[model samples]
Target: MTIGFSSRTSRVARVAVCCSAVCTLAALAVATNPEGAGLPFGTGAQDAKAGQEPPSLYRPGTQARPRAGAPRVPRDVSAVSWLVADAGTGEVLAAHNAHRKLPPASTLKALFALTVLPGLPAGLRHTVERAELAGVGAGSSLVGVKENRTYRVADLWRGVFLSSGNDAVRVLAALNGGWRATAEQMQDKARSLGARDTRVVSPDGYDAPGQVSSAYDLAVFGRAGLRNAEFAAYCSTATAKFPAGGWSYDIQNTNRLLTGAGVDRYPGLIGIKNGYTSKAGNTLIAAAKRGGRTLVVTVMRPRTGGGLAVYEEARSLLDWGFRAAGRVDAVGSLVPPRPAAAPQTGPESPPVLEEKEEVTGPGWPAAGVITGAAGLGAAAVALALRLKSGRLVRD
Candidate 1:
């Protein structure tokens, strides 16, 4: 199907190109750090295999199939794409066009949270700086945090998850560095999580050029985010308060599911995120829990049908997921796999790491060490790495 890809085509193309480069540089950084990609995380084959398989696969005429005359799987949105999963098991219950890339709008924050969640310092207070207000066109839902404002790192996350506050996201991004650096890091995290259809061009999920992700990728992020008790608690909130200048601004969650509107007008609604733009119409990531079962749903570019089109799609998907596999005890094994003896566990002569003498992108890469640059820089690095291994380009 032909998407109405706008003239911002250059921006989107540049994002893909840049991310390729960032991936290359990130690989180099890890290699140079001597830690490789195996820092605290175990580098064993078993650890790598975890979360790599479908949570559950149904066999025809098995107990896993829905009962006779149970609801059929939902239809895929025409312009939109989606995936539904059993969150507890990380098993994809149903998916349509799961690999297709599309604008994510504010839903990009789902990933923004994932990148920062691991690093949030316990009980650390961060002062919001004036320079953090750098991005243009932050929307109306700001915390009204002033220049030189102070807030707890925890509160900043609350603002981001609950209010979808662009200003809060900006402050967090600025604290990390500029959006350019933070976005590069975000893409790296998304890659590490195996989100093949995602790229971040903005710290907050603004309708910026080249900031796009697929429904499948969003589902992955939403599931991951829910695992964070803090984020889950934040999203579940219907209202939040941030006070300044002797007054408190009461911010409400934009997710209708939390508001008991639209498809949430049904039952068992939990929380996630919502997004929209001229390019990306009424996108949503939603989840529901009933009888100890959790399901995540994402939809993008819903046909201009109506307001709750995306929510309706989500509800149907959620219902199907519960029926497809009713309350599996586990998505992944809770017990750790038995350890296998390493060929040589004592770091006996670290594996010889290879470095290419030259690097290039689609165009030529200037002969230099991979530096963290945005857009084209990232793409160039990915391309150079590909060339070093003599492998054809693959997304």
Candidate 2:
């Protein structure tokens, strides 16, 4: 005797079964390798020592790992290391091999700007001497500022951001009392910002033997640089005139995200920086604002055989970050500076918010989700399960 229900009932049963199967597989997958399930931040064993792995933002005794219900993390990004973070809160939303050190190219200029912009008066004008222009690396991008021409600090900044000008960096570094001092200051600033992986051997971010930075550090620089009005203005300026003896040259921003004239132009795109060299591949630190939220994305060493893959990858991470903003838990937070010690002889001061570092294991599993593209496949399975569960209940 055939024991079959009506067609509608049969269809519902099939869907319910399919959904259950999908959900079971997804659950099994997550159980077997929770680290590989596309959760943004780490929810793994903590190492005793700091710096072993990227720290987690989720506090102890909380649900620190990414859940199956979390938004599907993007997996098509091709950078060797990348990170996306909430610009205001310093929360690291997603990362892939974020601490892996590599050549930063011109993206390090953001750090240069952060370190030096605070010291130079915006209106300070200095005549460019031949000596100031010397030692610019061969084939470095330039803004064509001729020697013996006076440029305001603001204009030199424009040259720096608009053209990724190594010459501008040199000029500014000289003004700051030579490249060595500037480099030392930049490295100090990086350390203060919790960017431990950065070592600034060149003020202009040239390909030096030990000039290295990580995606995490670049994001740190981007966030810090954007806090300065002048830095923000310089990076956002799409075009400006650079004065030379009698003729002025119009320089345009090298960051295509802000200009909207490239392979992709993002709305609310602001100033940051981009870089490429034979050794560094392609690097970008991008920022954008939407609905009162600002996001910074850093991509490094993206496969660059063709079109603006760096920009495209940056845009993708930005889109994903916006979509995932409030949906996923922060895997980590950018460590804030330690509060200044109170003066020993001063009046009682307000309590300062103490910063703590959350440690993760040597094999930080959260990286597995961010770095491995296969996490999205598990997300697909989880989605199928959710759909099936809903349909079954309706039936």
Q: How many steric overlaps does candidate 1 have?
A: 9
Worst 10 residues of 1 by lDDT: 55-64
Q: How large is the C-alpha RMSD of every model relative to the true structure?
A: 18.9, 18.1
Off by over 4 Å in 1: 1-70, 76-79, 138-141, 261-266, 326-395
Give the residue spans of candidate 2 off by over 4 A.
1-68, 304-307, 337-395
Report the C-alpha lDDT of model 1 over 223-274, residue by residue, as the tens digit.
8888888778776777777756466777777787677654445377768888
Could you tell me every candidate's TM-score relative to the true structure?
Answer: 0.65, 0.71
Colliding residue pairs in candidate 1 = 17-379, 18-375, 18-379, 20-378, 21-378, 21-379, 22-378, 89-331, 360-365
Q: After superposition, how far is residue 76 of candidate 1 from its true place, in Å?
A: 7.8
